[model samples]
Target chain A: MPSELELQISPIVQESLVHNSRTLQNLQSLTASLFGVSAGILGLESYDGFLFYLAFSLLTSALFYLVRVAPSSLTAGPRYFRGPFEFWAGGLMNGLAGFILTWTLFYGLVRA
Target chain B: MTWISKSITTLGGLLLAHACYSAREHSALQSLRAASAASLTSLPSVTTSLPLDIIIETIVATFIILLGLVLGTRPLRPIEWRVWAGKIEREGEEGFIDGAGEVNKDYMGNPFSALESRPNFVDIRKQRREFAEWVKKGG
Candidate 1:
């Protein structure tokens, strides 16, 4: 039996939600790696490298909202952002591990 | 691909990984020498001699891993109304519901509208008894 919550959401809305999440994951991971490479090449130290990653990943999230999510989703939901944590802040945290991994590897390389 | 093909590919990858690992170990000493000469940081250098090469390697590895994640996984199948509706209507030769199911006989009216005017427990029991008789009679 379908629950009241399940019955309320249309199939199209479900599909859109899934699609948005997949796109966001791809964007976040890719940008995190790229940011790591830039930090490594620039020879940024520990604190500065992390700061750079945080800033860039937030930028990626903002771009994702403006370009892909805003026009289609603005009128439908009660939430300000499409997903949780309101875009930039959430994506920055989500991508932090990936960013750190690449950043550390490259930092070791350039600084050494 | 088939299981055999996938296993073969995995074995090939394992071989490549082993080879790279051995090569990386051999080059580590040389890289350390290069690292010590470069800057003030005492962090150990990886396989590459130059910083640019390391950056490029990181980028390429990221792209490859991202590509594998996107394409290597099985895609999700979304549930759609039309597909289930077609199965209910028996419009095609093949559908999700099999012939053994009791629902093979199509309902005459919109089924959802009937939800508001549903049969009571007594009515349902009486209908079940009638269905059992019909099955016994091979109808």
Candidate 2:
């Protein structure tokens, strides 16, 4: 339901996509360091819940960035996302990332 | 009575959440401690043998969050007309725009009249008016 006047997506969407793709790549790389699985095979792994969410985040981010950065439609996604989905997804990403960080650091101290 | 009721509700909620968390932690630590204490033979300890996979996963996740927070820090510069209009084009500065269209720099380092586009304090009101117009137009 975007209006005709809004021409481009916001920079935030591109930023989100970059952030998500990087995080997924980071996670994929971590599998190798922690489990000795090659990075290539990890990329081929089936989409279970965690992997699915991870992949979703990456793909969506990439798609958002791709659509947004094309000069004309950059603001389109942001305009459409003036509703709950944007707010909710942004919240989820921030919240999950924050929780994992706080829990791990404090828990790490406890164990150490 | 209203204040007292609200205070009691808040206190109850806090106590309930605290108790639940304490219970979870206490069970994990207390049982492990009791089990270790009951062991008759003293074995040489190397690593803690806690599940490394879970630990690392948690740590990595936390670090990702922290990295975002760390990187997301933004500067707090206040926006002023002289600061922003300088971006469009200085009064007489020069720079290459897209597709070979050239722009002159303003005193602001904007592509405008690079020499004098930046306002002296003498023209603060004019600068504010221009800035207001820019903001009204969604700049």
Candidate 3:
């Protein structure tokens, strides 16, 4: 989190912040369901399934950074995101429900 | 660029669907075999997991889809006010175009444009002269 003084020194654009976060959230939610489908096809269960979700979601963040954030933000460090945590791990909880929903549906479909 | 991502995503979806179908068939075949074996003898039937090929296909397809999705996402804007304003000044409308080659609806152009083109500073006589010349030339 940036200090109030730091924020005042360099004011943030609220519209840009919202745009960036919304883009990331959209990608995370879409890929979370994709991961779940693959996990289901692999017959992963319980902890294994959750672990698969964790690993792949992290991979998604890394790929997103490489493709988008890293190109323009090499020197200043992710100008679109507020902090490292927001860029990397913020979407974990946002997509968990969608992941589980598709996981169980596909798991049952494949097994049945 | 948009088409590239869309095609890649479609290809990945096809591969994933095929893998899912293969896994389903494999499980169904295993269950059928298990039932036959159980009826034929007293020994318990062995359960088989998905083939390695299917697992690999599923994982690879997922990765391709992830790449496509990341590529498909809209370009992000700088969060800092100065950086954002500078981008608008430097690139104008070109800076805010989306994947479809259209200007973003939210793009309002230069924020300080009102100050730059204040109506109060306009030369009324200069505008009236231009309008009169146009009328005289045609009408």
Give lDDT tens digits, candidate 2, residues B63-135: 3432332222221111223323442443233322311244422123433454565545358888799999999
The reply for model 1, stretches above 4 Å from the true place, is A1-12, A73-86, B1-139
| Per-model TM-score on C-alpha atoms | 0.40, 0.24, 0.93
Docking class of 2: incorrect
Model 1 residue A16 lDDT score = 28
DockQ of each: 0.11, 0.04, 0.86
- Scored by TM-score, the top model is 3
What Cα-based lDDT does every candidate model obtain? 0.51, 0.36, 0.93
Ranking by DockQ: 3, 1, 2
Which parts of model 3 are misplaced by more than 4 Å? B119-139
Look at candidate 3 and give me any clashing residue pairs: none
- Residue range A1-112, candidate 2, lDDT tens digits: 3454442431223333344344433433322222211111122223332353454344433433343223333443222233435422443353244333433443343333
Pitting candidate 1 against candidate 2, the one with the higher lDDT is 1
Candidate 2 segments exceeding 4 Å error: A5-81, A106-112, B1-9, B24-38, B41-139
